[model samples]
Target: MSRELFYNSQSAYEKIHLQNALIFELSKVTIPSIREIMVGQLNFINKELAQKVAAKVGVQVTELEFPNQSLPADSNYQDLQSEEREAHTKLSAALSMDNTIKNTIKGRKIGFIIANGVNALHVQDLKTKLEGEDAVVEIIGPSMAQVTTNDGSMVTPKHSLTSIASVAFDALYIAAGEDSVKELLMANNKPHVLNFINEAYKHCKAIYFGEGSEPLYMNSNISLKKHIDPAIVSWEDETPDNKFIDAIAQHRVWYLELERNTQD
Candidate 1:
């Protein structure tokens, strides 16, 4: 179980729900005469809660201690006892995140919302920076047709505004250009574009509004909020690209979900 499931639970109701879920899953184990189970990293915050759930299922919980000594250099894996193999497997699972966690933004999917006459410089500059960090960037336009940038450069969109929802990407960037913003605000596409921004805002995902994109921002549900949201980067921010990248790396601002969704 993730420690966040316990420590980050907002209320008693959520805690109870988690406990019930744990009990249901535990009770489904069909092994007969199961008396005790060893759970690693069963520390202070989650240990007591876990024990209560286990007790409801009639099982005793024990802390799984890591082996202190290293195995012999010539030891054969096939000769190890089943119990030893199980212990090693559990240890690996417990420490997996330690090896997997890294300080990089690799593989994050960022969506750039644009229309014909989009700001070529803003689109290219941010895309270059994000791609340099190994993040996957996709251009989402009003349609799949080639979008003409302010510089008259043609850019192909990977997705249309109506085709993909905000949930499909890790973060969103509203590309800048007076004409592009105007095109996005047209009667036919305004609703879809606003829905994209509002949904991404509601979900606490990072959203960067480039220069000349204020009209869309003011028209979206984001304008309704009075609170300062770090994930919602605007052109007024200094170094907006860096701020957007940092926000994306942090994933979602889950702590502010309530405020973001509240009807003001």
Candidate 2:
């Protein structure tokens, strides 16, 4: 009877040990699945919050998709990663611009952002110079309605400020005219205009503002005095159009001044 009791106790201990080991192995698999689901739920919640904030600010938010998977199976090629890297490297190398008349405005589309009371003579001269170099020039206005320059010449615009984005143009010119600047500064939804200029500045595009248009820059959200971006050519009697052309030929001017100020 004593021997039988001892054997039964040993059998019970073995069963308990096996049960514990089985539970330990099962937890290893289940815990990671639980963690993965939690992580997925957190990401979804974060994205929903972001979209809500964007909606409040009147901006649209888009989610990213895996680009490689989107490619058609027939068009997909092997070793595309190395080919894409090589293409990008070549593009970066080709983007550098040299200061030369040969580089002058050729094949570039320049936009003259103007309003009513624009300086007709200045616009004419600048347009002539730019077009002479085979550059395309377009007049962009705040509205589709015809605008009369200070000289009483009717100027028609190809696109409105609201319709076209600043990224469409390689360079931007703000014509000289007090009344024009006043209209721009006082217009309802004026930030649209300011935002256009700000976006151009941020993109490092060549920008020119005619003389006596200080109020336009001063009042706008951008503080040009505090931080000047390169390739900004302000024209007056002192600065020649040729100089502006040279600056434009240099393509993008470094945003070092703005970057340094932010760090300080």
> Please, what is the TM-score per model?
0.64, 0.59
lDDT of 1 by residue, 82-185 (tens): 34222212123233222334357789999999998888998999999999999999999999999999999999999999999999998999998889999999
Model 2 lowest lDDT segment of ten: 86-95
* Backbone collisions counted per model: 0, 0
Task: In candidate 2, list every pair of residues with a backbone clash.
Answer: none
Model 2, stretches more than 4 Å misplaced?
Answer: 1-102, 221-228, 254-262
**In candidate 2, how many Å is residue 185 off?**
1.1
Q: What is the lDDT of residue 40 in candidate 2?
A: 36
Work out how many backbone clashes candidate 2 has. 0
The Cα error of candidate 1 at residue 33, in Å, is: 33
Reference-based lDDT, residue 214, model 2 = 72
lDDT of 2 by residue, 1-264 (tens): 221222123333232332334334434654544433333332233444334333333334444222233356776445342222222121221222221234656888888988889899999999999888888999988888898999999999998888999999888887888888877777563676787788877666777888657776665545644555556677653555776676666555544323533554
Error of 2 at 48 (Å): 31
- The alpha-carbon deviation from the true structure for residue 147 of candidate 1, after best TM-score superposition, in angstroms, is 0.5
